[model samples]
Target: MKPYNRRLRILCLLLPMLCLSLLRPVPELRADPSAGASTDDREILQNSLSVVEIDREIERITAQQETIQQELNKLSGQLEDKLLQIQDQQSRAGAVIRSYYMGEREGLLVAVLSAKDLGSLIHMYDVYDMIMEHDRTVLDAYQSEYKEIKNTKLAMEKKTADLEEMKSNLIEQRARVSALQQKVDQGIASSSDPEALKKMIEEFTLYWENVGLNEVKTYFNALASAMNDLPEFIQNQDGAIRTNGTTYNIDIKEDDLNAFLRSKNDLFKQFAFHFGEDEITASGQSGTLSLEVQGHYSVEEQPQNSIMFHVDKLVFNGYELPDTTCRQMEEEFDLGFYPQQIVSFVKATEVKSTDKNLHVTLKLSM
Candidate 1:
């Protein structure tokens, strides 16, 4: 059998199992299947295990922080209640003091001092003294209440500030958890599953090559078409290429492509295509495009071989071609081109390939 066919057979045999491994819940550290494996496999296994450990640690910290937050929230509620009570007591104390002083000014002293005779005068004096003493006692009670209220408020404020600090810590802790979760995800992606990773790598490689090829094709086409129409700002030359219904002059030097390609960066887009379907499943910013790629076949005739593409980066020139319509075609078809109609120029920097579907991301400089 051909090398390709043999590779395809191995891949078909291994892929489903590899996918199952990926899908399975990350193994426990002690029970990890790769624990006793070869050196490299053990390294990868240890890395995966470490990620799982970090993720688990993050979760634990998050739970602990959540518990602390709940405590803080509960304390906050209590503080609010205490503050309100303090305010209420202060208000009541103020009202009591106000009424007592107002009433004192309103009468009893003058009434008592104006006693008619001897027996009445003595009784009135005693009554006035008793009233004065009662006023002093009320004032003392108010002062004591005020002091207690003030002290309680200070304590509550301190508790509230501490709770706020704890909440901030909790937020920071949760962010750490989220960051760790992402790391774990990446670790899973990087795990060296040869059969599964192969297709994606091949696809990325091919797609990048395609990006460069398509961009060059597009630029040459546009230049040949717009030679005479170009403004004096752009130097016009005789080197041209022809495509359907158009003659594109290559006014820009060949080295210019290097500059444009260098400046242009690539953005990778990923996609998946199942065995039975001709259509590719993809997600895009604008909308989904219905892409159909020709099938890659194996010698054994068993749909065993598949290719996957991933665009690592996209790089391109910032210059716009004169033909705006063709420029749109470049974007719509994921070709590399500049159009007067487009807001910016795009390029692909890196590309990768695997043995299932094409994925590409083009970087645009607007």
Candidate 2:
């Protein structure tokens, strides 16, 4: 074949391949998950954990303060009731005293001496016994109430002192966490190769895996314990649980969640959760450090109907994490939630978030 003819044939054969390549869709690029582990990676994770753990200690102190406050309130009410009882008992005791000493109501002694027959004497004896019993009962009740008032007042004072101390300690802990967070931020900013370090951090998703999640784990620890002692927040109630035959769905509203959290731990006061368009966003601020996470819930049936909160985005200190980091985070963490952690009466089958609510589907208990 002639050279020109051969070249023309090759071009015709390659033209179809070029056209097909142009028509095919490009695959999305993602972060490399198999990046080799290194010492720097461990340091980043450890730093992240330390910061989060200290922050959680701050939360724990705040929760303890709230508990002390509640106890003091209860003691205050008891003291008030005991004071009223004491006042009423004082009046009763005064009457008994006046009757006993002044002989103002015809003394039992006079009745017995004036008795003219055996029947009259028996009646006098019974009357005296009844008067003595009444006096003794009133005196005993007054003494018991007085003791209770002393105990309640002492407890209230002690709790008040404890609350004040905890409040001071909370301030100190917040300062410490804030300093640690700033140190982490400075280290990231001052790295020799900022982009490379940032890439490594993203590939590992340490911020989501350790920093953001450590707080959530501590919160769940408190919630799991407290819920065991309190009424189930879901089921057998209006606007929360809905049932059809053997299946039920529990709708957990944003307000309801925050309220329950706040009641259990004051750490939730600065943290807020919002539900919007099948997604949940949570943000928390402490001193100069702040973080925000947005995600949606997904169900896993193979693993005992487990529900996971998939992190799609995380913003810390005004920096949005790379998409690669978010994807890695979704694979690694579940935001510390399991249906069994929330309810014991039934098994959860599915979990989905909607605008203003987290809907959980459960099989009715037999």
Superposed Cα deviation of residue 198, candidate 2 (Å): 5.2
lDDT by residue (59-81, candidate 2, tens digit) is 66777788788888888888888
Q: Relative to the unseen true structure, what is the Cα RMSD of model 1?
A: 25.6
Model 1, 250-296: lDDT tens per residue? 22332333233333322112222222222322211112111222222
Model 1 lDDT, full chain set: 0.41
- Provide the RMSD of all predictions against the true structure, rounded to 1 decimal: 25.6, 21.3
Consecutive 10-residue window with the lowest summed lDDT within model 1:
281-290
Superposed Cα deviation of residue 212, candidate 2 (Å): 12
